[model samples]
Target: MQKLKIAIITLITLLSAKTSLAQQYMKFSWKDLNIDYSAFAYLIDSENVIVRINSTQSGVLKLAEAAGKLRVHPGYSSKARVLEIGIGEVIYSKDNKMSGSFPAFRLFQENYDPVTNKVSGRSYVAQATKIAQKGYLSSRPDVKVQVYNKLSDVQQNVNAAAYFLKEEAYYKQFAKPSSPATNNNTSTNNNSGNKPAASQAATPVTVHLVLVGDTKDASIGESVKSDLIKMRSLFQNTMSVNKNIKFNIKEISGDQLISTNVENTVKSLTVGSNDAIILYYSGHGSNPKGSNSDFPTAAMIKSSYKLENMGNLVSNRNPRLAIVIGDLCNSVPRTRTALPDQPLMRSAPAQHDPARVAQLLIKAKGKIVSTSSSYDEYSYSLGNNGAFTNSFVDALTSAINSHSNMSATWDAVLKQSYKEAYNKTRDIVNKTGTKGQNGFYRGSVAYN
Candidate 1:
């Protein structure tokens, strides 16, 4: 009888432990509930639903309804408490196209407001494995509320879903058409290459871009290449919109990444007062024992070069705007292994306003310096891309697509990018038990 009593007590303890774990996993702050749902077509048919949930308990249902993709049915218990919310069906577009889908989800509340008829808590998701299996819809209704298991699993599902949704939206909106050769030749000859005399006479503004990457390292070579490609694409798309502005890009990698070659390339560049110069470096870096500056020293295969010196080289040219970026470690020199590749989502292409692009890129005047990691921190990379570089590209793309041109300043974009990189690094550390990296930036390019 004693043994039986002990066994029952043990089972009850285990169940209690599990319930506590689930409760902890479901706790989310108000900021966590801010999800962008403008990509869907349901809110008002023609108008996009860009909803920001102000109240924790009352907004979950509104979000589901506005998304137009989730069919949620709420159930109440004897005391008028929500027992579970059933996801009845996954609704697609009218043409039966797979526009979007919802995973099995639930909202937890701590207190109920009698006057407002609202609860006070946050929405949460179940285990990633279960959510993945039942996230999409079938022809039949899968009406069930899943229970939360682990916080890590919940985060994994949320990040994965958000990444894929952004990618899908980007591809649908901005992907280039199939035929590039014919269209490129026509556009080049008629639109850009052969411009009218009056159009060419405008104060010619050229953006000089210098990209240096350490492609010799086995672990981060691919990442350097990926950053270079994304950087080129961003500048090409944004700068090409203005006929008065021209782009000049220089790439130095492999054997050409030596200090001498890098210095000579910077010195040889001819920049005008109306022009902008940007230099981006990606590779291994280190902070020496007694260095004065917090920025990392770029470790090339043959020699090391201080980023401050490089920034000075660019700033001395006296361009309208000078920006320098180093996507590497700012800690002691050490070897690193590549992490598993995460899903990469590019910014959606939008019709950019010429004035906005010019306001941030051309009209802005000053020097900006940014680094992937702060002093004593180790920067991280996933497969073929640096985390900070990817975040900067994402932020820059968003800035270009901003509703107001005046609001899209270089300082705002860089600051947001650094914050995002820090958050991403934190998430990676949480999952892999690795050291965290914090990005840093100083100076700004202000609007004229």
Candidate 2:
């Protein structure tokens, strides 16, 4: 009996150790997007290790030391075709050769009508430069034509063709890799403060800021242009003043949706573990999932359920300094639901949460997250800019004035922005005193 108990204890210990090692996060980037190289690393509960790719030339798939080898998705391709710029007129004659002053139109897939088998939609026409008075065989139409037209249109067409091809190339490059195995057994930090080793020198850290503005739901007056401008200025000031810190800044506007495109960009930025990444998002918040009566405060997904794509960008242990600041209105009453026009006045607040964003913050290895409002709060704004964004900028500027880090700046900005916005629109919130405190949500978490 004593021997059996000892054996069972040993077995349990091994199983527990294996389970703890299995859960991990893997991060990828643009280079890894095309070829699965050493773009990703694994962060186990205890130790994190770099995922080394063995080959880049021979096989389509390669395995990592931690995450097994993944096959690259087969990229898409299409036949290339020449496009004609302009054509004046086309005339068919009996002879094999035909002539015209204006050049013939070049046919492409878009211009050609498959149903009609003719270039019906195109402006230019195809004309044979060489013409014979007596026409040759009509059955064999395999003939060459010389095209001519305006120089400007030709230049434009060439550019268009190039752009289209480039877009297709970029899309194919973004295909996702095969999911890594989640085995605990297979799954996978250090700090030195004062004294440096004889061979070691502290390398100056480079902080990369990728600011994305999500204003797709912006009304005519609530423009986010000024907020973006202010954000840029803050980044510039930080980089210019701090001799030890270098910054690479990226600004994305509403033109870039918070979808796969945004995800790809984030992946590209956060791949290097040495980087300090600051991601700021300004936009309208919505829950794609329907409202819940029991827990009306549950957060909603703005779009699809396959939001893992967005989550994957920050889910891995990639960056050294990661700060995510979001300026979003979480408590906007659903349009279908009968709620007050003034979000502050809604009697029965629909229970919606920004849990997705919260979960993203937790998944990040080293992170500081600050939200404009609380999970259940209705963030307000006025004069064509969002309330939260304006406050966020104000807070950031204040923090800078105090010579504080990014987190301090956000805290100051958030407080100042809200103060300014509330002063401007006190009447709205004053009327519904009941939901006053309940309508605001702010998240401040520090993980270094």
Candidate 3:
């Protein structure tokens, strides 16, 4: 009897060690949406659960179904089984009224012990809430329990098994390897900083910036002006390093903000193969009814022009890179009231690395088309600056000031900017009861 007891204790220790190892946090990517997910697996009592952190509504739904179909052979608890799959709501409330809710999910487990003729349960819940200031979801621990007595209880719950099973079938059709065992899309940090190769350093490049703003609009005129100034400053600071790199900026505002003038300006510009052209417009914008494209049209005083047209023109020049940005409302026009300036707590200034800036602006090759708001969303302005523009500038600034040993990518900048803009818009809407805005970006830039 003593020897048997020792063996049992040894087996229990081994199982606990295995469970601890399995609980290591993992990262995954949904390549279809270019979204990354992080999760960790662990056991709750005798039940096994996988918790995914900071996921979108689609991601949570998909993951919840995947969790239901997940079968653990020789699981931590030999008699454990998946009991439930559902999303936890992150309710956004104002004045005691629910304004919005972000979707979150968790996997729950139940175990039966034959010796004790008893059942036990536990769950791991993850909330899909924005990280403060960062505006993106991150993995954090949040656990809750909702026990079900039997299989019938799970069926009776609003989060029915049938729903998860149906979703599981739909997701299984296109599901790539998301499990840690098969996940190989891990991101590695490049500590090489922004140092260009000798050949790239010798290449002469010219960055042409065409900034267009509608300074006539009473609502966002000052904001447009501020955006232009900030953008010019960003470019000048970034390009100040290489003597071989020429930085040229063109401003078209006031009466020259017409579509013809804008077209003429882009038409007359001559770009070389080693050059980059950036067109930024800060003004009213809209999506026409039944518009096919996801991009918005720049709403000028008397006319509206498609941003895709400008993007194509810039791309036609065959420059190394082309970026077209429109910071405007994609929905119907509405009167915007500028909020009073709130003093922000400033952090210590980051030391800028010119080589890193050059890597993104000069060495990179490809086009980027982005907008301040998605279709049918309002682009917001705070004080004298558009929220998206502020977020973009901040992202760029952070990239430039990143650790000298770390590499920066335009993709990261764009994603960060989009998330930050979304968070900013959401916060403003929550506070002032304004419409929310979510920025969008597409295209890729390749950097060596």
Top candidate when judged by TM-score against the true structure:
1
Q: What's the candidate order when arranged by decreasing lDDT? A: 3, 1, 2
Write down the TM-score for model 3: 0.53
Q: After superposition, how far is residue 165 of candidate 2 from its true place, in Å?
A: 46
- For model 1 the TM-score comes to 0.55
Write candidate 2's Cα lDDT for 1-448 as tens digits: 1111000000000113213332222222222113321222222211111122222223221111111111111121022112222112111112312232122222122233323323322121122332222342122132222222332332332222211111122112222333696877652301233211311224545566666664344341123443454465445432233333456777665555545555667767634666566766655543333534111221223432122222235545366546665555444342111112221111111111112112222222454555554434454444334555545544444343323333433344455655655554444442225232122223343433
Q: State in Å the error of residue 294, model 1.
A: 0.8
Model 2, runs deviating above 4 Å = 1-202, 215-222, 287-312, 315-317, 332-365, 402-426, 430-448
Off by over 4 Å in 3: 1-200, 335-337, 402-407, 428-435
Ten residues in sequence with the least summed lDDT for candidate 2: 4-13
All predictions: root-mean-square deviation over Cα?
Answer: 19.8, 25.1, 22.7
Rank candidates by TM-score, best first: 1, 3, 2
Give per-model TM-scores: 0.55, 0.39, 0.53
| TM-score head-to-head 1 vs 3, winner | 1
For residues 1-448, what per-residue lDDT tens digits would candidate 3 score against the true structure?
A: 1111000000000123233422111111121133233332222322112222223342222111111122232343345432222222211111223223224332323454434423364323233232232522223332333333333333343222212222222112223323464447654433243444422366678889999998767777766766775576567543454445677788788788888888888878878888989999988887756889888888776887888888987898889999998888776555333565432222223455656667777779999888877777778776546778878877876786645333567787777777877876675552235556777778888975
